[model samples]
Target chain A: MRRWLALILVFTFALVAPGTNPRAGEGQAAPEFTLRDIDNKPVSLKDMTGKVTLISFWATWCAPCQVEMPHLQKLYDTYKDKGFMLLMISADDARSVSRVKPLIKSKGYSFPVLLDTDTKVVSQYNPNKTLPYSELIGPDLKVLWQHQGYTAGDEVETERRVKAALDALAAATPPAVAPTATP
Target chain B: MPPTPRAALVTAAQALLLGLGVFSSGLAAAGEGEERPEVSVSGQDDLEFRYWRDDRTLPDFPEEDHLFDYWELVNRVNVKLDRGPLQLGVQLDAVGMLGAYYYLNDVRVDEFDLHADGVTFPLPLAYANLDKAWLGYQGDSAQLLVGDGYIAFGRGLALSLVKNTNIDIDSSLRGAHAKVTLGAWDLTAVSGVTNAQQVWQDNPNKQQIRPDHWHMVSGLRIDRYGLGPLNLGAHSVVYSFADRADLDAQPWEGYGRGVDAAITGASVEAFGVAGLDLFAEGDLFLYPGGEVLGVEDNQPGYAVYGSAAAYPGRVALLVEGKHYKDVERVNAVVSRDLYEVAVGPTLEYERVITEDSGAAVNSNDISGVRLRADVAAKPGVLTPSLTLGLFRDRELGGLHFNRAPETIVHPIAGVDWIADSVHVLANAGFRVDKRDDLPGGVSLGADRMAHVDLSLGFPIGSAHGEIGGDLRYFMWGDNLNQQTDFTLLTANAAVHLGHGVSIVGYTDWTDDPLIDSVGNINENLYAAGELQLQPADGMTFKLFYGAYRAGIRCAGGQCRMLPGFDGARLSATINF
Candidate 1:
């Protein structure tokens, strides 16, 4: 019995040791990926570098995700002109991809919806692959915040984080130079 | 003053209205750019009335007949408040029954007796209680929560506290929980008291109500991520039972102090590895000296589970295996109800060996393997799949497999099709169980089982609605080589009549050969029609009349038998 216990301890230590910083942790650079939107148009994360980006990984079968979508849309509409963007990435696989378009259309949402058919992009952002996962990336491509799961009224905190990031970005940008007469 | 169900319902409604008023007023008072606490309210109420014809006597109470007419109303309310980093939530449930149901009335004699200290209500019915109330704080890197809540770890293999209303089970722990993330490590800890069971006893002289004893539970888990694509985790849980000699005198006593137990496990999972994902976990259970059927001894057990899946191109394949030995020890300390207690991991496969069959895992002497493959025949249009499973179980105390081992093999094939407005799904499966080296004269259980299910749904373009139908058949070959079969057919249709009004109708028919006795066929039919109105956003009301039949309802590997009836149902829901 003692031997078994020792063996298990060794195994756990071996797995836990030797791990470097995670790629998706706060202050780490967000990975870049290109995926197709609901209309089959390519969307790349690198293109949105000058603005604060909020990427949410969700699925149609997740109840909490469904509840959070409307709030996300509201946030997007409220801050779209203030250098903020929200992208809802659907992790529906090939088997259930057919249900995504109809659901989005039925809900009358104007936010851009992307399909992660193979779940390749979501895995880069969320190693655990938890549903309704949200990550906020600053204008500098560094992850500002990350959250797993959702509950009613969680939108408040999420909105606060997004606004704070946007405010910081605005404060960092230099003012525009005065226009000069034509030479 | 004491309040009845009717008065309670009125009070609840008034309180909700008052809350809404306050929320609105608060929102109005907040000036532009001012921070205000966010409040949200959501709830649903279901009222159903049933009438019985050709009433039969209940098996338990042979002297009395089943209720000829009855009505029940179930209401659930949830309120959430959030401001900055602090959060508060409350959820309440109330159930009221009125009818000729004597048994149900007797059960309500002491409904208000067992409540958490410092919590009180005007109406304390058998079905009314404060389901959940919690206060929590969310930080950038940590979270602290207290009061009633749900918790789970690593696919719930070792510990899971959840609530399933469909099965009338709520295992939410009343406790304190904390989660923190430090660099590459994530830590979680929980300490709580399990919810007590509500048992009702009916006697001629006096009605008796006893609450199931509660136990202490604590657990800790640590997880490390960023090992490329691999993440590892370790978890341990301890259940402590209080010494209660009084419980020994009861006819149905729960786990006592003598049967304290602990579970420890470790898991490793890897994802995004060349389109392959893998996970494996091993759990060890330790039980101090305990008496099993009057025999006392300490028996330790262990279990191992692993699964691998790969989605390469259009084809998806998965393989899983599990082996358990003498690991089925009672662990009610972490569960709200005794029936919902489970200490073993559940392995889910297709039909024959379903996940809902936790009994298969509780045997403590079983091993199983399952393999499945799915191919996208036409991309998103059609998909077909095939599955195979094998399970083996050895005798109670035998180390060798030759001692009356039971083996089962199951194979299944299925297909799913989806188009612009049409969807269809079907599956067929067969199971064969073989036994070897039977004891002197013991009989075999089920030898063979087969089943088929088909469902089709489509939109009625002209009517602006949808219609669907389902057909299912199942056959069981019992020990005596006798065959029993069940057939079910159902059809439903709905239509929108504009102005936020809709009409829906459904009918179900069942034919079972084993409902009563051998060779006695029982056929039942149920029909229902409903009208739904959604006059505005966040509000809906539905009224329906139906004739229903009793049947088994299952969800999330849990099953419950619900009594059927013929009656009307009214429901309303609002979210804001």
Candidate 2:
């Protein structure tokens, strides 16, 4: 077993030796997963391509997450029309997953809410399993910003990131022609 | 909430790369990030130091009788690197077990074996190992992984194969997993042997860790969506077991050992039909071994579950039903530990599960129905909900304390309200599980449980600081014949100072003799305090003291009886 571990370590180093820049890599593309939304409709990461999307990992039993959700709701309502998407993925598991949709409906949150009954998705992005974890991804599937926990007003920074991504999205595109006056 | 940009700028494939680069630079400096960094590294470190001790209050013994003093430190670090589509990750664990020595672990070992508590020490008191490593690739719609992975099939009735962190059980398949999404169809398959985590995060450490058993588990799942309002899926799982649990053998060396059992299932989901969302699944458990898991029925088991949900205006309602006949026997012979491959969601409220209620959670021949409704009394400001669950346990043996058939009726009411800076969340429930159904339909015995839990939040002085606390009370009426009734209560107060600093004081009182926990305050009480400091985002440090009680905890259809903890600990979690 020790020898086998040594072989594993040798391969590990060999894998890491080819890296060009370590610090340059902060954000990786989000793993693609398909899950049923609150309404039993399938929602996939591929559905959110070409958009600046903010993914929030939350649970019904998490008090801080409950307090932070209203702020996310405001962000969703603010940016829903701006080609900005918000995926409120619940990590409630099977125990409290039933409360996810009710909680979201009570807040009138129109953002897409996905149920991660097995906690697979949250384990991927936030290995620490921190509640109310948020990650901002640009149109290119690269994560632009990530934040953990919430302090009521932390959405200010999240909103700023969303604005920058949207502005940059608009800046990099060719301006559309204005419609001519009708006769 | 202020107004945001009217146009979200929805879709623009042409600017995908340029927009990502410009946005990356606009927020962060140049060279820090780009549309897709060639090599992105992200990792997490969780380290804990514990000073384990205990004292006894027996009349025959003196003060601090059977005193056990041990100091242990366990650290786990996992790092993931993604270069373009290629991803590699590994988790390393280091443990140091010091102090008190132990005799025979099995007690039958007349031979004296000096051990540090449960582990025998030889070379050193500290050891480190490469816990987990995996290599994978993530493309546009396809994902290929090898080394270690997690998979859950349809509602998990047939095959779940996922992590259960609550009980400190993270069993992964030490093999390969592949998935591809083509248009509206998604296909996923996995093949490997079960690899349970060696160093437990919550439980004590053990030496000479190896794979639970060389159980060759393989499965394939396929789903097709967008068939109008109907979506369909099906899955099949095959399991092969080893004849022996040998620790010295290599993984999968015993595999070509004959197939033991298989599970095949199908599921259907429908949405946006007459203001309702419906889902149903049916699975057949094939026990090819004739007599499997000590059951000589030689008959196949089956499980059927269905749920319907509706959101009408400000109200949300859901109704679920399940009938499982000998469905828990699959994979029962694969592992001598807590590694279960097939688990389906249960109707019982897992958070409020007790010793008596846990029986129904793992009952093989059980059928039940649950109805829940939530009303937004005043939208987000105030909401109230209620849930009622009913179950019939026909054949109870494993994990069942009751000897006769039983009926369970559980009703819970909850409310969530926020009044200007003050928020209150509370829930209270009483469950009755009556057994020995007489010929006239009357129960001769019953096990009852009642619980109440709540959390209150208060805004502090004008500085935006916050103060809150949580309280939980449980009373159990056990009818295990020789069991004793018990009550458990825990209360805590939290002070959240702005800028990611918080302090919490926890108090627990329990008289459950079944729980072998040493209290910090008195024989029947425990106390603890934790100070959490988040210097910056994505990093947290926690310093804790005192002890806490233990009990049976169930999550995601899986239940385990966790041991009580008594120690002083400090931990840190950093993700970057």
Candidate 3:
């Protein structure tokens, strides 16, 4: 038991100290990837720079993902104006990618939805390729936390984390000074 | 005398160092006039340990026979170093096992060994090795990578070297990959041999793992983007399989004309054109070796896939179709059992994939179409969706349980409602596959299936509770090769108290004869419990104890029969 504790400690310290790539959880720097959003624009982890970003990997054929989508949209609405961004990437390959845009448009989701037709992006984060996987990254692009598979009340916890990240970002940012009136 | 494991490792280390020295020097010389910024190093480690038992092992043997207590530990670490436009990455894996067993020749056994029959040798199953290493560079207009990496060309119809976790597939190319962006055209090229992962994180290993056969592969893609809503692209992949008995003694030994196959494809994507998004792709599969698995004519195969979507105001509609003839044969000669080389979209619902429905996902001769429509019934409060899919399969070989041709039709409807803290989501579908007459004007009954999946989350005082269930009923056709009709159901409920705490209960019941496990509570029912804790922002843990049955699971156009487990599991995922 002591050995197990020591092993866990070492792994945590090593990754927390100077790690850069994402294991999709705390102390990890989200991995790098490139994808095309629904509007045919390039999107990547770099877009989250200087902002709190939530990245979700889902598919059109996954039922749990659909259940989570409505909640994600609600979360985005709650935090979008407060230094927040949500990127919902589809792992639908070429078969069901076309439905991604229509579904978003119909639901009126404002977050950017990227297309990972080859599933390369999801592999970098969760090699097991669990559906509805998500990661919350801070302004520095370091992952704050991650969640796998979705439950109905899972978003309640997610909302708390998102708010904390946003508050942290807002506290760190210095308010803009008004222009001095000329004498 | 054969060298010891330590000696072998030392020699391998020396060889790797030599290769690294030469490789870095070559790249350094090419970048003589370039700037080298401060190099930053970062990486991540994922470790999973599973200790469980099958409970099927009898009490007649020592240590509870073969399928008793087993544990396996697997860890994969990826380290990346970056400086300006240059990057280098190395990934390694460490695997250890004890008392692990898998079915071999209908008998539960550990990794194969010719020296021992009765005694278990768990030491031979432990291994640690270097998985892959790669170096990459990115400029303002060009990108190049020279070691092991993933690549996909044109929706993966020609070459897709990415991971498919649904089937436990993780592979890369062991050569060079390059991409260049011109003013109006983007060109990408890759040439390498197959580099398959030796250990998997999600699947049970049954055999002694070894290196890949090193099938040579090369691909090229050219795309012209920003062409005023009309983008065009073309790509090609060439493969030369290595089918021999040398156990990779001499890789790249077969590149003759008779051992190669080429798949070339073209695609066009139009966005925002007349308020519609359209995409169409066509591919030609050319095999000069005449080694295609189930094709008798020795002629080339072709595939056509297209989709169109229109999102107007509050309503969205999408239609997609695919005609694939012998497209699945591309996987036959290239690491057939390890990974798939070309994977197109399968328009079937993935969660409800059964043996009968999964067969049509990769049929050599199949044509299908699917149409989906979503309407915003109440702005931000409610949305409903309807989908209809139809397909016909002409081929009666490989994995199909029917003897005659069949036509399949599926229709599904779903709705999403969100009101304050109470949310509801539900979906229901009906599917039927009608087989043609069996040569004597006699009817070969149809297979009919219906399923429902629903989830509800509501507030409970200051806390909240959620309930979800999936129901499926399958009626078998009058086919001699299939099993009897069956029904399957799963229900789960979770109660979330405050302060990062939750408890979940799970139950599964099935009468599917094809399934291989007896339930934990009875002959056809299973029950389990789980507790989740997130005491801090960076740490999360889950503890589960119970039993679950096994069945065939399909995803991303691939199918595999996953095994059942009955035991306790504790797992932790930490961000740091």
Candidate 4:
């Protein structure tokens, strides 16, 4: 009994220890990780420093995720020129990863996709590991908003959050100087 | 003594609620600015109440017992804890039933005994079980997992350990598993005890019970990826049973001792070559200490499976072949549960093979080939597919039966068309079974079987609802010169009544000539209606009334036979 109690105490201490938990949440700094895209190219979260980023965690087996894909594509098309980036991370395992490229091609979705076969990246962003989960990170590398699960018409709210982050980032940045003094 | 199933369920529910409350409070206390441990809780519940009556003159039970009523509630809770690289998950399933139905009383609690305070319990009408629990750690290129979890290897040809919740089948392994990746090579090792039960005795007056024994299993797999469109892998597993003396006293002593069973296999997969994909696997099974079924000097077993597919433009083609010789059915463990035993690699058209009107397809001692072709007339608008299958028993020295070999052939065609909010699907198939030799040296020739099904769904104009209908017909002729035909028709519609309320109704009619001839009973008719109210996100309430017929329900290569019912059901679901 004493040994059991000691083990429990140690486990509790470890869980509560400082810097032991690395979950990304609203107002918290987003975790950094490298992942490979469908083309087998490595991409990292630190690369997009000046753009509002929308990271969507998805899977082919998730019905809601499938429903939300087209909406994410639309959001990407509408905001790409406005300094916004969208990354779709698939949580499919190694066995089902082969189907990802075909499914995306069949659907004609042009957004960049990253493979999270081992779920290492997904676990850092969304601790619950729920599919159809999304996070909006500001240009400052802080998570501005996060949403779990999806329903019909939920994409409107997501777009609203993304636009809000984009507008905030624009307001914070200094405008470019006009080079008319030389004339 | 251990608590009753009901008491245990109630306690578990209470504890779950309390834990959620405390965790939520902790999160609130930590505030949004501070770093905190991650916790997630989610679950779903299904409640159904059924009242049934037998219409047949020759019923399985007496007339007085023909009419029965029952209610069942199933709850599933998933909890996850994550801190840095360490993660823990616990899934609990609790089912409580109060009914006079015999099927409900036959619930198997063998696997549940592992965590039920180590006390034996009777198969009660109300029971709950802890389904799965696991702890995992993820590092740069390696991982470790311990406890109950699912695992699969190499297209699941030789081994697949998974859970089928819809059919109440759980084959999770309980032990340790590890995986490591080095460059292009990935290796995995698993050592675990099968969390399943085996029936040792059959009581003439009661339901079958499981013995208190566990099976031990260990396996290793190595896979190499990124070989320029070529991948190779190999896997091997060993299974060992408990002592013979412990099993001899059991009722299944004649079934041979379960000591020393092993399977090893190699697989090859290739893609990105001329728009074609190929996969092939071969496995060999060894039984060191005699045969599994007590046969004298039984030989080893082997199986080979291969498939090839190509998709170019608007057309796709696929061909598959499989051969098995004296290979016994494989499962995560030997299960006493009637619905869970005999699990193997999931195959295409599994539902048709298992639920056919005639004799079901044999999983072992057989060789077969299948071909499928799909053509898209309008890309996503209209697509049609054709399928063909031919199978015959392999030469195994009459291990299965003394009768001559028989061959079965199946040909099927299907089409799907979707435009805007309208969708339609139709399928037609024919099956023929021919025997090489009949009893008394008489040739029975071939028996014909045919079936067709059509379904359509369309939106209801501007009402934001949908309406659907389905029609199905089947005909079969047995080798004994008996013919049977069955037809089913159903129509359903769902309309949003506005204000977060919806109403759905469905009606069904079935005509079975065989059943009618046996009991001179009337045709069966069933109807149901449901009213749903969604007051908030992730929450729903449904009130339903229906009359249903006994049928087989299948999902993920697992099937369960459900009893007929006429009932009213109320259910609520909430996730947070």
Q: What's the ranking of the predictions by DockQ, best on top?
A: 3, 2, 4, 1
* C-alpha lDDT values of all predictions: 0.57, 0.71, 0.74, 0.57
Using all chains and alpha carbons, the TM-scores for the candidates as numbered come to: 0.64, 0.83, 0.85, 0.70
Question: Clashing residue pairs in candidate 3, if any?
Answer: A20-B42, A20-B43, A25-B575, A26-B575, A26-B576
In model 1, where do residues sit more than 4 Å from their true spots?
Answer: A1-183, B1-68, B101-127, B196-212, B241-259, B292-296, B331-345, B349-358, B395-405, B437-446, B464-472, B478-483, B488-502, B513-523
TM-score of chain B of each: 0.75, 0.85, 0.88, 0.76
DockQ of 3: 0.34
lDDT of 1 by residue, A45-133 (tens): 76788999999988755545755676788899999999998989987643234345545643456788897754545534542245787
Best by TM-score: 3
Residue pair clashes in candidate 4: none
Give the per-residue lDDT of model 3 (tens digit) for B1-576. 334446545765775575556445544654667754544455445556666665555444445464557766666666665554566667776555556555656886654331122112225555555667777776657878877877877656677777666676678887888989887788999887877877676665545355455777888999998888988999988887766443333334434324457889999999989988999999999877655444456678888888889987788888889899887887876535557777777778777888788788878889999998889888656888898989998879678867889999999998988666677888899999999998889888899999998888888897878898999999988876677889999999988786668898999999988788888899899999999876654345678888787877775566667777677766554433
DockQ class, candidate 3: acceptable
Cα lDDT tens digits for candidate 1, B351-457: 23321133454456779887777776765456787878888866343222123566877788877665544556667777766665456765455455566655554
i-RMS, each model, one decimal = 18.6, 5.8, 4.8, 9.4
Q: Retained native contacts per candidate, as fractions?
A: 0.00, 0.20, 0.36, 0.01
Which should have the higher TM-score, number 1 or number 2?
A: 2
lDDT of residue B253 for candidate 3: 49
Which regions of candidate 3 are displaced past 4 Å? A1-33, A44-52, A61-84, A125-128, A131-183, B1-44, B55-67, B100-122, B208-210, B244-246, B249-259, B292-294, B334-338, B535-538
Clashes of each: 0, 5, 5, 0
Q: Which ten residues in a row have the lowest lDDT in candidate 2 chain B?
A: B2-11
Q: What tens-digit string does per-residue lDDT give for candidate 4 at A1-183?
A: 353344334323322331122232445555555576866555777677788999998875554576567678889999999999999998764434544665565455678999876454564454335567777888866667666665445577789888988888889989988878864
